[model samples]
Target: MLFYTVMKPLVQVALRVFFRQLEVRNPKRLQVPGPLLIVGNHPNTLMDPLVVAVNRRDPIAFLAKSTFFQNPILKAIMESGNSIPIYRRQDVETGAEKLTPEQLAAQNEAIFGRCYDYFDRRGTIMIFPEGTSVQERRLRPLKTGAARIALGAEARRNFQMGLQILPLGINYFDPQRFRSDAFLNPGPTIRVADYADLYRQDPEAAADALTEEIRQRLEVRLVITRDAAEDELSQQVERTFGSHLNPDDDPTTLYDNFQLSRTVQQGILYFEQHAPARLAEVREQLSAYLSELRQLGLTDEALESGRQRPGTRLSRAAKATLRLVLGFPVYLYGAINNYLPYKLPSMVARRATKDAEFVAPIMLVTGMLTFSLAYVLQTMLVHHFTQDWRWTTLYALSLAPTGFYALSYWNNLETRVHRLRALRLFRREPARTAGLLRQRGHILQLLGEARAAYLAARTAQRA
Candidate 1:
């Protein structure tokens, strides 16, 4: 299949290169003898699925959106990759939506009949209970699809061989980043006996209960925190939980004196499902624990400050645009440059003072020599591979404009860094601990301005 041949290799290579700190706990909890259901949160669309498929031993058939089936080529790819198309309400035929209870029942029977067949053959299926992706820390109200499907399968077989639903949480540190931290936590399997009857009584309620159980497990396994105010803790709870939380009423402290309410802990679990490395969950826990420790005047100031939020100087729009248009290129360049050797010394000379005379000629010559050598080696490789003079020439020629532009951008960034460093040194700002907490509003504003400028330059370049 194309998945094992092409897609899997690409995914493996990409994952190996981009993800770090991949700690998978209780991996054996994923194994089940009969049909299995894997339910978890959805973050990055393809990335999450890819991560799961690449890491998981089971051959999982996912219920994907119907739109992927629109294109014949894409549909083929999905089918080849073991994905099933599920028509969302909007995508279904108009007459189908207005069907009576009996009609709806028949339709459900047909759709689930296919799922039952897959399970009968002893296969694994994946579903996103949240139904959609949310970038925030908290989980959206979950849908009952996973629970309903599991219950349906059990009912069909008279619970002869019950479906084992596995709860998995993927934690990410800067998920959007090219190279980041990802951790996979596999919790205990939810048995058919756990909520099968509940599903028959009230399927929706059963789904909620199942999701809550998994959510609770995730919270206990993942929260990290340090000292902060009650209001700050409350805000964090609201942001991470997406539920109204009151820190004042029976305040939940973390760890020792910190009592975290069951609801708050559930919120923490849901947050763990949002990002890998359980950073947000851990951050909140750490905040609560440290806050309590601070009240007792026992928290370490140095560690507390280190645990605070990272400041972003850029605006949101600019940051978003930068993440796409600039982030990848910057990351690639950094990766390549780190691997490439340079003639320059690693440590700067101790005698080199801030007021020392500039050395532009030396810098320019060094850059030129490096570029020339790199270009020569690239040309030779292309020539050897293609074995066509014209093809090699074309490939070499194509680099001119791109290389020029990249060099200019790199030089500009280099100059800016130098200037900022000079200013910092001149002002005698503290080296390790400096600056106030960054505001999200300011970051968004800066991003907006930068994006506008980039657009202007692009428009001018096109003209």
Candidate 2:
């Protein structure tokens, strides 16, 4: 509890910096008082809980897997953060104690009893019902433990606990990346007492029914993909022409992007079943176009820019170049001051694990340490030379803002370089440049036709 109290503000800051846009759709739903069982799909390990926790002011007790408690240091941290361990069969079988199935059941039963006691006091509990974390856009078959616990807790209180289960659907636009986006969609609360009649008749069937309802609620709010192929195609389309297609996209939130992803995925699935030939044709053409763009060290942005009038293009280029040159000194100072702190996290994270889901959290933890240490050391060095507290404080404050500015500057510089390369290509090889632009135009044309047809089909289906 002491640890949680101290870390809450830090976690909020970390999450705010880590994600570019993280919008919770139902802000009021999170305000509902306990006893609440907050359930979510786990796409990123460790970070998912932190993401959910920062959204609410109240403390959320998390249910962690038994393996996380094996380490003595981690065990203490987990306990202090209001976490309770739930043993899984696999962990028990391979654990040092090697407990029997009977022992495992007894342990879980005790945990449920503890949860019931917590609910008696109206404590909030967070659980990932999907049981395990995997970095993908699909939900796994959820375990029945969450449902059983809710039902058991409610039944223990004679269906008068006033407990509710909140289902949060977390959509990570790019989880592993540093400045990615995420959208959180909260589902309506499910009162455990609503299923009291069914539970009395058959507890197991009641749990299944409740779990299925939870699944449906989560799935509808999530951007679910059938497989890798469709997900890849949709992502490619998004990166290339998403802005062009979604002209009215709101930058403040990623809900529109989430819907766009879901719609693109649905369109892909529709074509797969209804017109395999058209799907295959577009997929091949898209792959070839992207491959060529990569070979030329260009993006779809360059091809589209080629279509713009020369004066308009060069005028924009001139302004960007002047800014790039003027910002060089500040960018260098920031790069020098913040390079180690920015780079060390990713370097350490790669050596730590190969799992995609674990990368972001480890990077985040490592980054917090590196940057804190770097700032402290840099501040002390500045003070040692100047012996001025105010000067040192100002220097320390400038470190982070300048670091962010450096990042933005570098991004702009890269975009400028790409544009320069594109301009050179267009000048030296006019025919080749025109061919690429024409090919891109044709690709969009095909996409437009398919998009219209698929949208019409969707509308007709709904009608």
Best by lDDT: 2
The deviation in Å at residue 177 for candidate 1 is 1.1
* Per-residue lDDT of candidate 2, residues 86-153 (tens digit): 99998889887578899999999999999998888898999999999999999999999999999999
TM-score for all predictions? 0.52, 0.98
Candidate 1: segments with Cα more than 4 A from true spot: 32-34, 93-108, 196-463
Candidate 2 positional error at 246, Å: 1.8
Assess each prediction's global lDDT (C-alpha) against the native: 0.55, 0.89
Ten-residue region with minimum lDDT total, candidate 1: 345-354
For the record, the alpha-carbon RMSD of candidate 2 to the native fold, in angstroms, is: 1.1
